[model samples]
Target: MMKQISLMITSVALTFAMNICAQQSPWDKADAIVQSLDPVTFPDKTYVITDFGAVGDGKTLCKEAFEKAITICSDNGGGKITVPAGTYYMNGPLVFKSNVNVHLEKGAILDFSTNESDYLPAVITRWEGTELFNYSPLIYAYHVQNIALTGEGTVNGNGSKKFSPWNNIQTVEQEMLRKMGRTNVPVYRRIFGEGYKLRPGFIEPFGCANVRIEGVTIMDSPFWVIHPIFCNNVIVRNVTVDSHNYNNDGCDPESCRNVLIEGCTFSTGDDAIAIKSGRDNDAWRIGQPTENVVIRNCSFRSKINGVCIGSEIAGGVRNIFIENITIPKSSNAIYFKSNLDRGAYIQDVYVRNVQADTVRTALIRFEPNYKGERSAFHPTLFDSFLIENVTCKQSNECGIYMAGFAERPLQNIVLKNVTIGKVPTPYCFQNGENIRFQSVKVNGKKLDEKPTPKELVKLRVL
Candidate 1:
């Protein structure tokens, strides 16, 4: 009998070890998708802007020059349009074509004029999650593939004193747009420009594939610095952004798939990296989810969350992986937010190997009461979150704050090998289910509870 019992214990231990080995961290599983991304390529031909009558003296209106250059490049089956080192003042929008690369040399600056009228002939865009025809993004692309904006240069919006002030009177217009989204107005009919005060994103690539924006320094964005909507296979690498205007999220990827945001630095006014799908009814109508996104090797300094997942994610967001991040300061380190009005789901989110100096609010937050209406069209669900190997030096509020509705309790969460140096409250959970903490230390003490050994065996084996 003793021998039988010993054999049984040995078998169980071996099985447990094998199970641990077989279960891979979410980051590892994300590698297949990340590695599958292909770098954009361009033809050998070069179209120098100066060769097309573009002057570098900063006072020259280079709209026609840029238009002519891009057109010539596109007509010749696509190649690189080089902008040499000087201030190239752009009076209007620059639209890119497929297989084209706009390469700027080290001292090149593409300064956009702040005159609102220059952005006339509105284009289809989303403002605060609502789909409409708004003013054209400074650098806009639609339905193009293998397009790039590369080289070590700067794209300046020049929006500080002019564009940021539109928020003061945007209250009524904002409400009207939200109403339009809720009422399911035809997207083409929701036009706002000329007299409309809605701001446009600085660089928006809509419905594009194989897009790359690399080694560029962007500043003073009118709105979201880099907004990629309805795109696939996107890469924003080695980019530096410093935009502090209103609604100046560093990078906002909406309704995109197969995205990789790596080796970037951001100091912005809003969330450093906000992954969004769409808003409310419009999202439901569009019916496209945002998935297969990987954000890695980035440093963030922002007034809002370092990595945010919603408030506009009504079409659902899934299969997101964040790793090797450093956030010096922010309101929240990782925030997953949605309200009653935005009835989307957030799932399969993994955050790992992060370091933060100070988070003004919680290190991690999940709130179901974001700014929107409550509707039964979709039930808001937040689940399947894994956070490991994260360390934060300080937090003004609780270390972790998660609240779920009583009907749909947040479920299947695991936090392992985490540490927070200081926080007023280490943990705050309300209406959560199946939350597990293993080796999670807050304020120099391990969390006060853990699952029983029998229950531990049943937790998700991650």
Candidate 2:
């Protein structure tokens, strides 16, 4: 039995290696990044939607059909449940069991019907990592292993039909509700339980293992798209995620591990690529960090952040790498936000070979105000952040802003081979220590700290 188990493990490892390259060391740059993931077999099987009596009725709510199909697939050895080419108007969240793959074929759409009855509650899920007992997600994969949602189809979280897709409006509402001294959740009290209480984002795989989402379009989620919280060995590539409405973050890797997001296009309202752990007490409870994540070969447009971290990091995070990216036309290019209330430690993040154009807040932003969101009164630490080979043009404020509490400072944050539209002064560089600048430039004029003039000339020529 032991030998058989060893052989099975070896075979799976070999297959994974053959599909991509051998797994790179945590500190080493990958030799090559694969654009797609080859299917790996576990106990999960492939299930057809036609078997569950779905007739592709746009008006008809196919909740029962989808539930039946997922049930059937679960009863079997846990396989893939396919939605063929047509419109499947599913009403609430369709819960996926472990080892189930929800595939939507070409020209297929999993439309979310905007009805309260469709969203039954009392299950465990989150919005920005806050434990919630409200409406469920459009499609949820929780605590699963070796799972996926692939193929050329669309998962439409019909949020526009419900919530107000403007951040200013929602932010105002949240503040007004907070002033009113309401006891319920801020999202509920904000709208007085009337509006779509902020349509929760679609496509959340929570606490899953070995997940993949590729070759699909995730559009118009009321919230963040492709949120995988506390998952491991995940890959999201070759997907065009376009949610232009408010709070419509493209992809949020919150408290996940060993993730690779590459070859994707993101046009969103909020952060195009976000890293989170959890929010406040909920995050403190989970205490899981999103680590070993790589975001490469991607493009972004019309979002708040090209790449961002925090605003919810009750748990610590480390070992993040974002490389070979393009950010065109965004409010802010790269951002990092945190507060003392989070009680999380962040370290060892590297961003290299990034190119951005026509952006607002380019280069880097690490601020206590965090773009005027909330207060910065906690004790938080940020260290060992390296940004290199980055070129950004056009932004509003200072190129790089690192301001934090006096005690918990931002240290050892090296900016190497970087250039932005303009340069700005520091609020206080006392705590933001060990900030080395090598071969740096501002709007293409090379700065003085060029370690080697020959090497700097070569770099500038390129």
Candidate 3:
């Protein structure tokens, strides 16, 4: 009888262990997504741009030579187009094709012209969430698969000279574009390029798959640097961006999926990494969500947020994993902002192992009522955020600041193993539920409960 009892106990234990092994962690999907990504590769064949009448003297226009090399490379079953060490001037954009890799050698610089007319003959693109025919991005790929921009070199967008000044003059055109989007105008009719002051992105990949941008240094972008829209299986690794022009966001992945952004460094004028979907009606019509993104081992020093999720997230965002982030200085370490007009959901976000040296604003902030022109009455569902293993050395404002809508409060937020060293205000929770804190310390004091309204600090309207 004793032997039989021991056998039954062992069987039960084995079953329990199996069950535990079968249960998947929330992060298991991230691993699967990474594994499923197809690496962007090219054939061993090489097409040297210098062989195609390209001069690196920085005065001659190399557009024709580049076009010839890229065309020949793609026509002959695709290969690498090598740009040797020197400054090559491009008056127009370099549009990419499938299975082609543009590799720049060390000391090579592809200098883009600041002349607005060079980027005319508008391309189909989404600018700031609205679909329009706009100026071509400096480096653009559309509906291509298995394309790459690789090698140790620089792509300079001379925005400070001319393009940066357009920001102040673009307000009227920007408002008109938003109105067009709101009124459900046909995308074909929403064209604005020559007379409009809307700036173009530095590098944009639209509707692409298996895209890889690695080891390049980007600087002085007119608009967002490295904007990927409607892409899948994208990987941006080891790239350095140091552009401090107006609205020069380091990278904005919009309406993309299965993305991996790792080992990148950013010092930008705006958010270091801002994940977004489309704007409003345009996003709803497109019907694609930004999901399954993993951002790890990144360093940031930005004028705005370090890692952010939309003021333009109207489609939806989900299953984002951010870890091993180092922010030397930023307006906010982790920020989520969406106005009522956004009318979407952002859920299943996980962030861990973040270390911030200095933050001008809150360590983590959620502004459900982000400042924007609200045309509709649709509130976003912000839910299921798990932030842990965060350490902030100094924050000029609060440790945590959240202001959710009363109808749909921010739900299921868990902050664990977090410590903020020198925060003046601990927390400001306006409308939230199921917010649990474990092993969280603010200003050297363990937070046992939520602070009352009287203890809350007033925040300025950003």
TM-score of each: 0.92, 0.81, 0.94
Quick one: best lDDT, which candidate? Answer: 3
Q: Candidate 3, overall lDDT?
A: 0.90
Which clashing pairs does model 3 show?
Answer: none
- Kindly provide the TM-score of model 2 when superposed on the true structure, using C-alpha atoms: 0.81
Error of 1 at 105 (Å): 0.6
Candidate 2 wrongly placed segments (more than 4 Å): 1-45, 165-198, 371-376, 421-430, 448-462
- Quick one: RMSD of model 2? 9.8
Candidate 1 or 3, higher TM-score?
Answer: 3
Candidate 3 per-residue C-alpha lDDT over 1-462 given as tens digits, one digit per residue, 9 for 90 to 100: 999999999999999999987896777877888888888888899988899998999989988888888888888899999999999999999889888999999999999999989998999888899889999999999998888999999999998999989999999999899888878899999999999999999999999998999999999999999999999999999999999998888989999999999999999999999999989888988878899999999999999999999978999999999999999999899999898788899999999999999899899988888774556678899999999999999999889997877788888989999999998888888778888778889888898755333234665433
The global C-alpha lDDT for each of the candidates, from Candidate 1 onward, is 0.88, 0.70, 0.90
CA-only RMSD, every prediction: 6.0, 9.8, 3.5
Cα lDDT tens digits for candidate 1, 1-462: 999999999999999999998796567768988889988888899989999889999999999999998888888898999999999999999899888999999999999999988988999988888899989999999898889999999999987868888978789989999999999999888989889899878999999999999999999998889999999999999999998988899998999999999999999988999999998888999988899999999999998889999878988999999999999989889888888887779999999999999988888887776643465435579989999999999998778877777788788988888899998778777777888888989889998455322211110100
Better of 2 and 3 by lDDT: 3
lDDT of 2 by residue, 1-462 (tens): 999999999999999987666565423743232323334444536678877777676766788887888777767767888888998888667777766678889999888877755665534556655655445677777787777788899888877776534444566544443333223344333233234353555778778887888889988886777888788888888999888777778888888877888899988877898888876555665578887778888998755788888777667778888888898877657777776666677788888888888665445677544434444355556878888898776555555555656577667877788877654421123355666777777656665552211110000000
